[model samples]
Target chain A: MKKKAIIYGVSLGPGDPDLITLKGLKILQEADKIYYPGSLFKSGLKSSYSLSILEHYKLDTTKFEGFYLEMDLTRVKVNELYDLTFEKIIEDYNKDLKIAIVSEGDVNTFSSFSYLLEKIKKENFNVKLIPGITSFALAAAENLAPLCLQNEKLIILPRVQTETELEEALTHFNTVVLMKIKTVMNVINNVLSKGNYSIYYSEKLGTTHQFITSNLEEINKRDIPYFSLITIKK
Target chain B: MKKKAIIYGVSLGPGDPDLITLKGLKILQEADKIYYPGSLFKSGLKSSYSLSILEHYKLDTTKFEGFYLEMDLTRVKVNELYDLTFEKIIEDYNKDLKIAIVSEGDVNTFSSFSYLLEKIKKENFNVKLIPGITSFALAAAENLAPLCLQNEKLIILPRVQTETELEEALTHFNTVVLMKIKTVMNVINNVLSKGNYSIYYSEKLGTTHQFITSNLEEINKRDIPYFSLITIKK
Candidate 1:
């Protein structure tokens, strides 16, 4: 039997290096090549969340294939880049190379890797996704509570497009988790002020830069980070 | 300074022993005493999911404190038992012992550890929750899809009280995760049949006894296990 060649979508958890599962660690260590998302920074610096995790664990950086992505790129251009990257993955796979694409937090929930995942499925490639601890779940853990209790409903929204959406969710669900709320901070805070709800805000969870506060006032004192999330428990 | 006693709500992930985070494994190994839930089995065979993970990893069972709880116990009796368990944990803490309460899956989401958590807080005890991979997330991974894509909403319900709950959630959210559906299986099936959504049902995910399928016909061929869950995606 020829060596088993496969692609693994690895979830490295929120931010803590120690938060990675044993299975995830094993795959990263065993893989021949790894695909990591590198974000373009000022002064031409390219850094990726998933890549930082691999470096934190002192993994072999030589095997990493960083795909530096820019936020300003058009939807058509981004797909073209992903398609080119997929071709590279397929070329290596056919040569019997094990590939791993690293993703931050849980891969299935609001992940940029979804673009590549769709391509992998369309081409009928062998893929396995290793689940990780979600940032919102970690926020709840840091707040010393779970999202919901018995018979309670929990809804997770990416960002509130309208105040009514947030208000409607708050009315129906006992616990509401809002992710990537940087743009909708004012709108969300306004609706939340009316309800006697407890808010736990976390930014860059599990990493050295992790911030956690239950007071919304303390949160508004500064500009929220792109990664910031609010978990509202009633 | 005092030796610094603390209670850790350790989440052991879904079922796979390799699924536990490095931090969670470290705490369990370094704990002075570990509290595990033991369930009564046939022919006096007491077993626990959390304990099984520890034993499978060959951890020291001598330091284990088994708290055998029956499901049919009254709510009052359950609270009374948790109170008694809390007292024992407190006594050990006062003596400067690090206590860990092992919970299968994430400790916060639909966990029995919540009962102990309330007591730990009311009496003012130092506690930390180590987050873990949720079974539903793992189920989604096994299904090769994330729960939701960009801007899509996700709702999680624990055993629907009525058919309307499931129907309403499906109408509003892009993805619906129903947990502990054994009690409300018929109602859920009835509502799901009318929709054009795909269903992925998983039982005992990440374990050697794991079962997964997207086909509703294959799932209905046998009795669903208590640990079973279905992830509905549009």
Candidate 2:
């Protein structure tokens, strides 16, 4: 009997195709099937970074499945998506086929793929993770700034409840990276102003809409997209 | 007059020759000259990574020059290296030739190339920065782990620091990456024990001496090289 092939969760990195790691590109080329998450109304086009690799290599997208995972989901809806994706993956596994599930940035960072990893692991399915270039790296590169100073502390946080957490992070670390900044810009700006830290903000880094700004007041004046980042340097 | 060809700082990422970015490879192939740091030791090897790239492309290393930086003080040494390198680069610029300076990882992240950029800017030299794969991504991929957690915080700091600094970083962030871990294993271990965080250490990631260990206590029993990375996850 053939040993069951494993499922590889790969990060395609930000939008630029070349930023994908050699290992990531190799796995994408070799994998039997590629999977990406999408919404009910959209195809995999929303997460086109992974799609570009398949399209560039002229790989077959017919086998490319879009598993639905509602962004705003109740517990039941989340479980339903998980069950459906898991069932599809297991079906492929039983037939001695391998799958590559792609994420935008590093698989472990702010990725929905973790829920799937946990579901598959519970069923004893072997999974491998391949990390890739992160948006934070791209943002820092575009700004030509160091993420952290020598002996200076750093923290990267997604938006959390309470301004206290944001304040704590800002107070404790010399540098801070706030992901999903649209919702918490006011709180972050207040903290930055209070702490007197130099601020840098990048939106949709490595993409066409990518913009970097140092002025938080200007950032507040405009409505920013969901995929935004703010870095505070003390 | 021909536009002065721009200076590009390219990072090859760790030690894998193939891991060099497509953009970086293109720059290297087209650039009239390549510059690397360090002097010819008693051994004739100029640069381990640069030599590998040259050998792979069937180019001669003798055509390239080494800019040696004296190790007296950090800022002064970096300035000296940059001044010397810029002079050689400007000589080529006078002939309307482009130059590419290759570093080990993404040029903006703890890379010596940043010093060159600062010097060039101060002297009003036109330059462009081409970002490349960072070792953090490579190391995370090698370990098959995520560098940061979703909705959690991440902190990156150098291990060559006082024990207090390390403790402060660990205390504040959900995930912490300590680069250059070889020399400060004892201090790192002390912080790990005090903070009660699990340590995942990777040495020479993507290269031969690459090893990952979660056993914090075992770090003291082993010898670590300069390229090692340690991740403390809460």
lDDT against the true structure, each candidate:
0.86, 0.71
lDDT of 2 by residue, A35-135 (tens): 98755423433444456544655556676887766555577986897788889888888877878998886677777787787776777777777765677
Considering only chain B, report the TM-score of model 1.
0.94
Query: Model 1, range A89-130, lDDT digits (tens) per residue?
Result: 989889888899988989888888888998889978888999
Each model's total of backbone clashes: 0, 0
Worst 10 residues of 2 chain A by lDDT: A40-49
- CAPRI-wise, candidate 1 is high
Comparing only chain B with the true structure, the TM-scores of all models are 0.94, 0.85
Top-lDDT structure, candidate number: 1
lDDT of 2 at A189: 65
User: What DockQ class does candidate 2 belong to?
Assistant: acceptable
